[model samples]
Target: MNKIFALSAGTLLLCQMGMAQQKMVADKIAAIVGDKIVLRSDIEGEMVNLQRSTVDNTLPPNAPCMIMEQIIAQKVMVMQAERDSLPVSEQDVDGQIENRIRYFEDLYGSREKMKEVTGYSIYQLRERFRQPIKEGLLAKAMQDKITSSVKVTPSEVKKYFDAIPKDSLQFYESELEIGQIVIQPKATKEMDQYSIDRLLEFKKQVQEKTSDFGRLAILYSEDPGAKENKGVYILNRNDKQWDPDFLAASFRLKENEISSPIKSQFGYHLIQCIKRQGDNITVQHILLKPNVTRNDLAEATKKLDSIRLVILNGKMTFGEAVVKYSDLPMAKFDGGMLQNRMNGSSLITIDQLDQPSERDIVLLLDTLKPGGISKPMPYIDDQPGGRNGVRIIYLKTRTHPHRENMTDDYARIQQRTLQLKQAEARDKWLREKIPTYYIHVEDEFKQCSHIAQWIGSIAKQ
Candidate 1:
């Protein structure tokens, strides 16, 4: 996800302590929205959180000004929500706040570790964040309500689509709408013994050698997020992605202590607790993917090949075979049709195809066109993940690049129209309601590009 160019809470909400702490006491009110104050720390905190939470970290150089502008917009929204008597209940606010907390906990390691990192526990964190989340949600709801009246017609969609210059199109190198039935390679007793022995040997390296765990993680860790990061990053206590058993295990460790191999849905891991705050902990970990040999791939492909043979020999239609025998739950239900993850069309542009699978699909589909099918071919999505598995693909369809029309692309246009209409509505609401809220610029950002329309002519950057 892109670093949301939105202005929001930056530095700290409420956390107990972290694995590490930034020494700078970076708290300064950059703007005020009704009773809510936007702080420089808030923006910085969010940037840190966003960097850790999501992928994209790019920011406009005048990010503080951008954030301050959002504060003004939010203040206007809060006032309007109150005046309109929008009934945002306490339970509603608490629910959203708790979800975020849980996500943070899971992300960082545990609630206690998160607290140690942030200097706040889960309960205190919730209390500190409740009003802000409520206000943020309320403002979002008001904006939603404001945009609810906006609508675009089919003609508008076509006009918008056609108005785009040919060169302006965001082109993918290639894309595919692929279907698969996956079967995970079974991890049996002997494999487990082999993996555990290997990890145990690596564990002995840290214990016997004059070295620490981070150095070991850098050399041998398979975790992409940690391997290059020197095994350090902040995670909130409430994150939901990590396994609960693993999280519970992480919370019990002291600094520099190594964990016994802990198994999760993904694979087995060996972790070294880096630091502990209250409910949070920072840890470096090494992950080992379960060994899968060519024999394993061949075993899966052989089964799929048999199924393909049965279909070709007229024992069953391809669709019937997909529904009955294919291991891919998602594709089996769809009769082996796949949706484009981006545009949601059945269309597969040339650039949308994934690598390894891309070359395979292109070669397999050389003679075929749209509404065609492919012979069973090996496709792997078998990353060490919760939903990891291997499959043989069936290419259902491929569409050439052409002008997007209603017959081929309704959902894409509708979603785009909806977003544009919403943006227009939000801009309209802010332009009208901002004067009611108290706002000030830091003098440096007074001359921003978009502020004068939202605020007034008094401040110039």
Candidate 2:
């Protein structure tokens, strides 16, 4: 299993304290690979994090030993990455830390609650995570380098499958290939003007000092993150994720100055530059999306209804219909097929449809058979600016629960085979690299059977 080096702020703080408090005895090194060392507290900290985060609040037997091995491997990889001069940028590391902070803040309800729970301010959390996050990035870079060229041929996949005992073969639940054609109703030009005017008014209020930008954002911003973040975001000018128009507008503003309402894909926004430091800019904005009236939605429904007829009448393929009519951004690439978010596979299970909007459509799947398309139904699109939209679902294929077989489950088996091959390649690389490093294991962990190879390497040294 691939283990990510992610510990919550609270756990990380405790671990840091443990290392500091143990200074009287001198923080013991659990193991060393090349110039990288794994501190004893690092293992304990990860154990605590895993125990708390696990679904059952329990850990597997020998979990510590497993964690020790994983951490040592990471250290080795990080050392190799440095030798190879893999480029892990400060911007990338900071971006990961910022994302983690936002995630925990969302989890704990707000920034205040997150600070209360974690006992660390965002800045402190960033400082604590910086090294570990950077090390993780380096390790990942090395792992990717090791496995980059590994591939499995069809014969190898078949051979791997044949080796699995018949009775031990995997069982699979029913899966589905679901497709959709989403149509977001366009607001009339008058409604668009109305939204733009509202944002302009908000900008005027802030400029006149009648109200602050954050207060107006809290009250009126349609952005989901506005409730907690008050429409504030730290943006990197070079990050491609931000809407180009929005980013350009933000970069144009002077610190403490608010912009006239600017339109982006999401809607109209009045952005205030809170701070600027080189490429990183902190900004607050109030977003106002144009309202979609019942008539607008009905028109979209009618249009989808017409498109559905064209598909049902065999006049157009579902893929063609999606290409010509679907408004979803991903439709251009995926032809409206919903993919498993975890794996990007078209095959999805009912349980995988966890979002409310997806569940609504999943309920309709009970009546849909292979190649069946449902009537256009109204759903609130879950995207940032997607308030209300209409969609028609296409059930391309449905699988019955069964034992895995080469014929029915080739794709899944192929994926597993490829993963196994990659793991083998990584192990081979580790075997070749370990002997070249100066290895060490403290007396406490010397008896861990999993580390015997490292201990032997140390003996050879």
Candidate 3:
């Protein structure tokens, strides 16, 4: 079976995932599984979407047949999910849709550009995605129910590793696990007042129709995403990711009303409410951070230097220092380790450190050995408001270049072993469950060997 067809880790998100939906004409049924129909146009749409989204316009052979098989599996799982009365909340589905819209808008540079390319308004796109997103959520729920109990043991992991042909073993680069304790200096009261007064002036200009809010944000907002999005955000009331103060300040403003400068964790913001629908609000804002002087940077470095002394003397562990003194709140929970955004692994490579600040820290680890801590170093912080900060680097572990093996790559092997076991379990379930469903395949697609077992029992028309 193609990896796409196997429900190993989880059900794949819908085929059009974040792709703009294109209208289809002259559609015909491609296949039917348990009353759920897969359209020929659906497969074509997926091909077009993949072409647009992928860097290389390349696809596997027999792509249509593979897509047909994948869709059949999804339809069967969705049917089972409904039969089992699995609950998928409308709120969750809506959130995913909204996020997808924002992603595509960012991809195309703006909502207007996205609308021009996709021939759909934001409202129309939401309606178009509703059913597909709901179905995907149901399929994922059923997949989790089926494979939730699957597990792998140490022996199974070794067995999986041994079965891989020695010549085909993957080679890994030198990777490092790094930790840090950062300190950010506070700006003086004079600087804070300066930022607040600047925002108040911008608000007055917008209120007096002397300048545009978005233009001001584009030219002045310190938020990094403001460069691409013009400081615009579609916010949800229940979303905990937004700062409480910022959320409250934005929500209090009526449409077209600009708020007085308000302080949030990031900095001071001047918010202008564009539209609101129930708990969702569309707003634009300008974020400004108070300037830090040379003296302040030196003070922050001195503070981190002291924390480094405590850590080196064994009075406190690096993690303890991070929890007690690091300026970044979330770093404490992660033990100050920089994690790979793709896999959440503490072990990461120079390339995996996408941010320039993170890469700079790793580059400085040449003289430090494993379990060694470096002296206080100043680096620019990469956050919404870029700020100068000081940090001490701790190199936890380092791995040399080597071929895949049981000792060096146990975690990676164990994960792969678990996925294989889950795939087997999923296939076994499908072998039994497929017979119970009313399945039909077009003659052209019946030639796909991968799906032979699925449609073999159905008599030819």
Candidate 4:
């Protein structure tokens, strides 16, 4: 049996549970699957989120019924996962909850602001989000277990592609594969010391009660997020999103204790731990990044320009230069080749290259032919090490727009074919599994045609 369940339990559950706590309306059970209960508030809450998410801010007439079915299906998968003793680690759940909190924090600009908007504190939100994320992970694990052995053949891929109507074939946009060797502008030792000393002074002011941490952050923190977030953040130790140095300093501090000064990729920071619960902690901090002087920028440009000359003169390969001279540690292993985030390939779409942050790269690509390299250009580094730097861009490949074909797009077609076969297997599994579970749907949603299969299982009740 193959199944293709795309129900996102976290999104559905978060909207439902978070809103359910705030609303005073009486809630009723919409359906029951085995020991699991689906509430009317769950459906209504998902509808609310959907309405809020849309461009026109509208929901379909069948939105409630559609959401209800998805929730029911998700609940079924979760219950089955539990029965099978499928394991989802608490650490993984905590990491996911932290990621979700960080997402909302980024949206609202701070944990405090997020609380103000959502009417729930970070701790309360975590408690609400934990179960849903856990359930979603469990459902995915069960799905993987079910589909672990599924595989497709070359012939199967061709058969699936040939069966598609020609008019329905997908048209791809032009994509560019560009690479680079980056050289980050460095601050002099004196400049680094100056920033650290400034943070130490801010720390002293806060400790002496001469200034509030938030006030100092507002005045002095150079972190762009801190400008809006008031330098406050909730972090989980296991979450990799935080800079390692920042995370280490944050966890090392006792509640109400301020760190002297810490250096991270972002720059210098003075941290104060506000609260801690198990693996999660909240902190307020002031950041200060050393100014990259014109001299420093020129130095980096000169270094990269020299490296570019060496590559141009056939003195060293770009990849060898990346290993020996490039400051970007991550690009070294990949031979300085840029990857398409969608498919993890060296090929990327032109439309995908239309990011405002990549505007410089796009402009440079306009003048570059395949295997051509550009002169040193100034750009902002948005990787783990956030700094302004110079880089020589490499135009590896440019793919033109074309219809989906077996030769150029075999991997894409094969993936689509495998998904169809998996969906068929899942459908077969559902037909067999649905009867084994005790399922019920209220008469209000009897009109939803897609849930007819689940509705048929009502006879077992």
Task: Compare the candidates by lDDT and give the number of the best one.
Answer: 2
Residues 253-367 of candidate 2 have per-residue lDDT tens digits of: 9999889889998889999999999988999998888989999999999999999999999999999999999988889899899989767789999999997679888789889
Model 4, 269-306: lDDT tens digits are: 99999999999999998888888898888988898888
Local accuracy of candidate 3 as per-residue lDDT tens digits, 1-461: 43434321112223443333555577798888887888777777666655655678787687777777777877888889999999998877877777677657666887778878877767666777778778888877888899999988888888888899999999999988999888888889999999999999999888889998888988999987787889999887765547889999999999988899899888899999999999899999999999888898898888888888888899999888899998876796899998877677898987877786887775787889998888888877765457788888999999999998888889899988988887777777776677778888888888886578766754432
**Candidate 1 runs further than 4 Å off:** 1-31, 38-71, 78-142, 145-151, 155-182, 197-243, 254-260, 270-286, 293-299, 302-368, 379-389, 394-397, 403-416, 423-461
Measured against the true structure, the TM-scores of the candidates, in listed sequence, are 0.53, 0.74, 0.75, 0.73
Worst 10 residues of 2 by lDDT: 1-10
Candidate 2 residue 97 C-alpha distance from true site, Å? 5.3
Candidate 3 runs further than 4 Å off: 1-14, 17-24, 48-58, 82-134, 183-194, 201-257, 271-286, 292-303, 306-335, 341-344, 379-388, 447-450, 455-461
lDDT of 4 at 291: 86
Model 1 Cα lDDT, one tens digit per residue, 1-461:
11121232212342212212576574788666667776666656555554454456666576655555665676677678888988888767766776677667766876567877777756667767767777777676677678788888888888878887877755433445665555656666677777777778778888887666677767766676555576565444664446777787777678888888888765677877878887667877777767666677677667777876676577877678777765554665576655665555666665566544345665666766543444545555533234334555566545455555556556777778778767776876665566656666566666766565545732321
- Model 3 whole-model lDDT (C-alpha atoms): 0.80
Better of 1 and 2 by lDDT: 2
lDDT value for candidate 4? 0.79
